[model samples]
Target: MTTEQDSRASDAVQLAETTTQPSSVVARTSTWSVWALFCLSVGALALTALRGTQWIVSDILIVDGLTAVMWVVVTFFSGIVHSYSRRYMAGDRDIERFYARVFGFTLVVMTMTAANHVALLAAAWLAMGLLMAGLIGHVRDWEQAQAAATLARRYFLASSALLAGSLSLLAWATGTTSISGILAQADEISTSVALVAVSAIVLAALIQSALFPFHNWLLSSMTAPTPASALMHAGFVNAGGILLTRFAPVVTLEVAVMSAVVLIGAVSALLGQAMGLVQPNVKRKLGSSTIAQMGFMIMQCGLGFFAAAIAHLILHGFYKAYLFLSAGASVEQTVPKDAKSTDTGVSSVAIGAVTAVGAGVVFATLTGKSLLAFDSGTILVLVVVLTTLTATRDILRRAVLPATLRVAAVPIVVLSAITGYALLYNAISTALSGVPMTDAPTELTAAHFLALALFVVAYLATEFGWHRSSTRLYVFLLNRSQPDSSTVLTTKAEYNDV
Candidate 1:
């Protein structure tokens, strides 16, 4: 936003231009393909939703509104990304596997999002691990493909051990892995055992979020397709926050634990964001910012603001997806070098709006029952909505608009606004009523799924509406141009494809 920031942003653009073609998969123009994949992704989500809600988890667990909501968001975007890939990843070598891997990962995320037992967690985690490996290995070239596989495998292996360790600790003390049952007996886990499980889970989540010491995998993952990057940053990576959110009430009930989560989240948010500002890679910068924001959301959960955490997750997920898509479109395509001196033009205002909402998350955590808290949260939700709308505008303005998005954009935008409004209003009312916003540790008791329906609808609208030719004004609104050299460096490195 300042002169210094502007120069840094330009430098990032130059750097991305410099990375001719890394050993990565890029989807060239192809419509019918994206549509077909989008359909399958949606079907996968729908199936997962039905599976999560309509039946019991064998003899182990139950599914509720939270499961429903998580399924919807993950599924919707998985589909949207499918649609986006049609145009963005036109000439990719292994397009068939791209579709398969994405759809496969969609199911994996759905399973994880809906899991209510430790066994389920292990199952879902393993499935996701395999998919992560597939996604990384799908690239044709050895250097990139191998890097992806190796990083993904390490993530799987390490996180698997962490999952097993946490489960063993919880089972040893609580006697079962059912989330509901665990929460019911969370008080029985004695402080010592509780401390151990908390540490293991927290460490695991940090890995998933790619925070600080555990962030290299995210950087290494840049060699994947733009769509894969979109999925990782906007959808899957967010799962780490969801994990903390689901289990937060348990920790929050333990005062020391809650405070620790809050502190860690705040620190991660601040540090990750600062690092993002300096990274030149596009996807990397975005990924770092994601980790930071996720920390903010996780902090909200830690502070007993479960509903607000869900709000953050759902809102951020959409805009983040759009942004990844934007980056994918920019970098994957071979646009004329002399097309324009800088990216068309993007809005600082939109970025400002999203940042304001992130700030609201902090305020909400600090003043759960105060008017200031409610107002800040409301403002933050609107920032997300506005950015989604601006994204729609940008998408529509693109030289080659993806068909799936064009069809779904308007509704997605409208739905996002509606759901955002509802969540903000609910947050305000609950805070005003002096409700603490948490009922237990394992899951949100009042996670209204219909609201998630609204979230999915709004995103569909934006993806649909954003289909016009790129324009100077619209580009500026969406952050296509004008950044400082430092910001540019961070962003360029962030985006391997772009």
Candidate 2:
């Protein structure tokens, strides 16, 4: 080719690139702007919460404890994601589009948290789902990414439809389009209507949170970049807990329903953890873990402690976000290390059990809950104890400490974790004081006991490799844990450069 023609072609390509993607300076500016806005929103929410301000525009918006807490939590996470993405997503051809969608998603979620009108709530829910799907398929040229996005979009759409229908039914029955008003009149609504609406809501929450029988979407969504995945795992999945918490008054109205909720959560939590055990991929492992954590959060809601669910979600968000953003480090293989021995001694188990129980007692005392009470709080305390025990065992077994030091470290580590959790739990409970049924602990029913037994069995089975004893059980879990086929990459040859 002639020199003049080559120069002209290069200039044309540069012009096209300039038109399609924002300059580096412009992209960085937008990133910082969005992050700054989120920071400002957090401060505003904190001030509003501190001043005990509860603002409401009938059937439009409401700013109460629930709203304040969610807004602060969402904005804080969104800001962190934005700041991280600035560097993480650098050099992407569609960086501007990514930022725009993320910004829109964050705004819509914030709006949904404060939405009073059923229509507005439904609209925001739908919009956020679409935006997230777009983010998941940000690499539009990649077939696997496109397939993953389509698969997730279906789940999100189904969730939105269920939520919309539920909200409509509630509005129609209560003769109030306002969520606050509908919940206020929940008791007056007919049993059939309430049941149908809450059932839809439960299903919606399940799909959105990627709880089992509906969890493949999350697994498939690994096609998204790390930052988008972090935002999704951190903020998006928590929407289910937020939804259930927002509808706590109505959800607590039916015993049979709550029992079912607990059962589903238990099954999903166990299954998710079981599936996570078999996953070798780091992101997939994290995805499975998220499913389990969301299930636990839902279980908390089922136990009638929506405030605890909220606190659990907030903590999970921070922890999961960090894990995702730093996931690349997990792939580094500077030196091969020997796997730790799993031969935990009986003494370690005894110490772990004792320390865990003690931590649970401390948590209960700090939170004004009774460990011995035959109520939902008792069940929650038991869960805390079991979780702490598991964590204690892991730490003692993994840490390269002397036997005596390991024994001594159990109480110190477990107690510190429980204490910090209690403080955060108390703060969250206070922040959600205005929400109805935030801590409406119920009497221990047969169903509750059964669910707890199953939970304990699941944990022990996973810990002891008992689940692997049954070939059928292991295969079922492994098969069920897999993402959709189209979303899986079979070979590098499938790549098609833009």
**Best by TM-score, which number?**
2
Give the TM-scores of the predictions, in the order they appear: 0.61, 0.92
RMSD, each candidate, Å?
A: 14.8, 3.9
What does candidate 1's lDDT look like per residue over 1-498, in tens digits?
Answer: 999999999998876653433223333222334445456545644554445433456635444545555666777777787766665554456676787778778777877866778888777877787787677667655455565677767876787678778877887787877766676777778888888788777777777776655666666676667777788777777776667655654555456565566556655655565455446567777877787777767666554656666667777788888888888455554546653221123443343334335433434344333334333233333334444454444544442434444445444454455455455635433422212234223222222122223344434443443313335434432342222222222445546653
Q: Count the backbone clashes (under 3 Å) in each candidate.
A: 81, 0
| Candidate 2 residue runs with Cα over 4 Å from true position | 1-26, 334-338, 342-344, 468-470, 495-498
Candidate 2: residue 73 lDDT (0-100): 84
CA lDDT, every model vs. true structure: 0.59, 0.87
Error of 1 at 55 (Å): 5.8
lDDT of 2: 0.87
